[model samples]
Target: MNFETPSVSLNTSPENESHDEQFVNNDTLEFKYKVLSYYNEGKSINQCAKYFNIDRRIISRWKKVESQIFQTKIKRKRCAVKSIIDRSHFPILETQLYSWINEKRHQGICLSIILIKLQAINMFNTIYKNTPESSLEFKASNGWFGNFCYRKNLVLRRITTSGRDLPKNSVEIIKQFFSENCQYTKHEFFKDWQHG
Candidate 1:
């Protein structure tokens, strides 16, 4: 049996009447320029996002990154540097945090404990406030910390079937649920379980 292969011709211009879609409209280019200009004028990405009804992140990428690469400089300030993760502090913070994690592990405390302890020590809110990816809001005795961890990919999430809170021994229950349903070990619970 013989099979015919599909060929793509790069030599022929799509605009040269050689392709099915041969028209490049000027309006599209004009609209793009307008969007870029709005972005260049120090408008918040959210503002441009609302104007276009697109995701703020998309507008941010276009304004701070994509636009800089593609468009001419237009009397605009450079994109403001957002508060960033300080790696120098990570070694110190991670050591302290993991030490606390170990202590909590011995007590059969959950990962939620680390978050709570951090907040109690006044470290979570102060030191990590400037960290871009750390949104450590303390809702003690609530599972918001777990959801935050799941969102940040610090741990995989087992889909919660209901709005109801998991029972006591939630970690073990969650671990068991994942073991039966998914093939991966829940590493987020590993240190606690190991110490316990």
Candidate 2:
């Protein structure tokens, strides 16, 4: 089968530039198919690499893992990378944590980072209750908590403190103040106001 590689553009702008920019080859799958076809047709690895504009080592490696890469029942959707949370191990943890967070938030309780981390540890321990202590994998460390927060879009905000004790009428008082002083300049108000 003939394979056509997609055209790649090097379009970039100063504003869009990033320090951690990655070079993404969009035609990786096409390249793999082309390499496999060429190799099977008795073409030399060097010839295939030169024709495809791919590295010789990459072509050779692809050839070595040809069966595993091409003949697998389940095709890989993403590049192989380590995830912060092993979803396979803790399948229900995300759903459980999401519900727990929602319940706590609905009850008007703000969760601190420490409290969230503690809760995660508790949840992990509960899930692995039957497993031996030595075999327990989840530690619910600070790093893990950070990843969890990022994944769940849970932001931890600092609780603001005020000096004066605010009454229930504070919102009404604020609205009244704004309504009364809406048109007056600060200088005009201070100059015209009588001393108490």
Best-matching candidate per lDDT = 2
Query: What lDDT is reached at residue 57 by model 2?
Result: 88
In candidate 2, stretches whose alpha carbon ends up further than 4 angstroms from where it belongs are 1-89, 132-134, 162-196
Model 2 lDDT on a 0 to 1 scale = 0.68
Q: Encode model 2's per-residue lDDT on 96-190: one tens digit a residue.
A: 88789889999999888778777877887786687655376776777777776767777878788847789989999999987998798877777
| Model 2, total clashes | 0
Error of 2 at 118 (Å): 1.2
Score each candidate by Cα lDDT. Answer: 0.51, 0.68
Question: lDDT of candidate 1 vs native?
Answer: 0.51
C-alpha TM-scores of all predictions: 0.21, 0.40
